[model samples]
Target chain A: MNSNWHEEAYYTIRTYEIDSKKQATLPALVKLMHESAMQHVIKLGVSVWDLEPHHISWVLMRQQLSVHRLPRLGEQIKIETYPSGYERLFTYRDYKVYDAAGELIAHSSSTWVLMDTVQRSLARFPGFILEMLQLAPAPELCLPRPAGQLPKMEKTDHSLDFVVRWHDLDYNDHLNNMYYLQWMLEALPDELLNHGRLRAFDIQYRAEAQWKDQVRAEVQHLPNGRMLHRLVRPDDGKELALALSEWE
Target chain B: MNSNWHEEAYYTIRTYEIDSKKQATLPALVKLMHESAMQHVIKLGVSVWDLEPHHISWVLMRQQLSVHRLPRLGEQIKIETYPSGYERLFTYRDYKVYDAAGELIAHSSSTWVLMDTVQRSLARFPGFILEMLQLAPAPELCLPRPAGQLPKMEKTDHSLDFVVRWHDLDYNDHLNNMYYLQWMLEALPDELLNHGRLRAFDIQYRAEAQWKDQVRAEVQHLPNGRMLHRLVRPDDGKELALALSEWE
Candidate 1:
């Protein structure tokens, strides 16, 4: 992607941001992407908080990350994000991660929706926001695969239960969507975690988890070096998210 | 503390770094303190990674934070760190947090030790490091209070169990010490968390939580607006850390 075509930011992988092998962890990258996207929106002259009086906030519906190589600890990487227009319900954004040499180390595409905080339902994109992000979608970028097409829960090979903690919450007082992704990855076998490097992953957030909600993350092995995962609120039997990951 | 007397850095709290009230959380401040200290150590001409050759690493023993108020979202704050001096086995460092107006918002004192990573035991400070940091201990500073003096667990008022997940592990393959503080705070009463503001907290690291350790966090209420906490590895009955917190 052309560097001038989108908003760009640079981040140095901090010591704590990396894993055992000194490679930046998935959570760190996800945080950067969100931060960058949020900043772009602010620069576009609208802050998410500006929608607060209207009881509206942007929520991630789906995100797909493709990692060619994870940056090392202290490695400075550049990120570029574009609010690549909107469809009927979801607004699309794309991100590109470049190394010092300007090589594309990773890229991601995400779909987001404006949520009605009070009603806990989807809100139509505001006309102002639509105009602010009306840039044409990147022809080179592909949409995150529809969440429905991702595998459903099958026989669970591994599972872990977690209670949403205060730190896991955001200003919305709901469990931040990022923790679901962390729990999904954490439910994987320790052997794979210690040995494998994640190459790509897709996450689709389906439901919101509240503070103190007891949630379970379950993973199933799929054919051909892939894994399918889901996070569910067993109390209500609501599936919170679905994800697919591949590693090598 | 005079600005010239210590190494300083400024950080603007990011969106996700704040709480529901838009105040920067404890974890955010702790991270900035450690980052500034690490950079100071590097500037003194030796990187922590350089110590790897000798199988040595620096470890936090205790930290005490006094917060007059927490900085809010989008606020730029200044942090100053001073590696005061070393005692028989512990090295002392102090941090001061200031608002944009230079008013003190928070301050912290920490005790640390060099550890033989393989042995996981305290190691004597290296001669070169001693020379680099021999700058006189700040006269105005006081040592972090002895951890043993913190209240012992009498009755557990609230408790929560957590499994050390993959993301919790640092590069050393041990649960990064910050998570203990987070868990300790998380186990508090939800009402207190929602309505109260934390005034101060002191944490002492006793042991490391490894990947997949099933750990339990217990908190006990004390008189005069205080609380005590302990994080334990239930399987082996090991106390990983102890903390005391006060709120208003």
Candidate 2:
């Protein structure tokens, strides 16, 4: 892979980004990854601003995030990102977060699909996008392409209903992906949140949830300390997203 | 007053901080002020971490924010803050936000109180805190002292119930002040939110809301495009906060 396709940025973990443990929260970590990708694409001349005139926008399809150790508040961390490669309908990107000591703290791999905002449908990746991205296949995979399908739980342990708020809607006028992880994590028992730390998260977005949409999140704890979370539109029973998390 | 008493920080408006109009949202602007205050206190050797060991913390009592114009997304802004003065039991601080061209976009004046976390009661300012802060009273104020009493609305135009989410709780274990503004603005009618921009916000915090608490926010639109917002605990009808906002 060519190194020119990569970009790096530095950030200081702010108090708002930390959880009760003073460590970065899962959603905050995911935000860092997204920010890194945004910065990287902007540098590549294919940012949202560059695509808006074309009525094109990028959307996340799936992501697998693994944490070695979460960075703490006030810590300076470096986020590095690169385009891994592109398949027929999906483009892959990878991100690595390193703490002040230059130790890898966390990494994530995500798949994205191009969308036609005006048409409200999936669109083929324009050749210009691929040309601008200049993606080169990585020599090795960090994590197996997020499981194609996360198993559905036959039993439910807990559930919560949420009305998508204006803040939850992003510039794209859809619920941001990070909020899915947030709602799922919030549905867990307090015992897990208070005592355990998130180690891994694998999530897939199935459908878009617009502002004011009612979402129902259900969670089922697995025997192996993992949790399966499914979010659906209560009115239509249409699945919005599926996530599996490992906590330690 | 010594100029050293003042501190300034620069921030680039992030995508998540903007509203549909592409301008910084009211809550995001409030957050910038909060972040500026936090940074200033930390520079003075009295950050939250410094007081945590003593089981004491800082809390916002009242804030009066005035906006000339909201900054747009991606705009670089400078936030300047300093201790304005201190009265009997209230410490006053002020903030001014300027756009990249040095145009003042917004300014705020706030009064704060020290709290004893363990006892959950208002506490007197420790002498050491005052000594460390080295506050020099500003020669002028940006806005008048927040009205001592905001008139109770006789009629309500809209109301919404919100169960405080985990994300709403700050490091202090109480609802963050910005979220109060968010909930209030979210409760406004779509026509108002889509057409008007916030001009001023005068808010007073009376009580704290804990996790899972049901908060009902009531908004009454005044004749002058102003709004009176009251947040209360539905079960006991205890008012947590009251806010008055002017829109243009």
User: Which number leads on DockQ?
Assistant: 1
**lDDT per residue (tens digit) for residues A1-248 in model 1:** 33333678888887778887888888888888887876777666556678888888888888888999989987899998887667788778888899999999999888888888899888887777777666645555644533457877679999989989899998778897778888898889988877777888989888889988999999999998899999999999998999999988
Estimate candidate 1's RMSD in Å.
2.9
TM-score of 2: 0.95
lDDT of 2 at A236: 96
In candidate 2 the C-alpha lDDT for residue A181 amounts to: 86
RMSD (Å) of each candidate, 1 decimal: 2.9, 1.9
Model 2 chain B worst lDDT run, 10 consecutive residues: B136-145
Docking band of candidate 2: medium
Question: DockQ of every model listed?
Answer: 0.73, 0.56
A149: Cα error in model 1, Å: 1.9
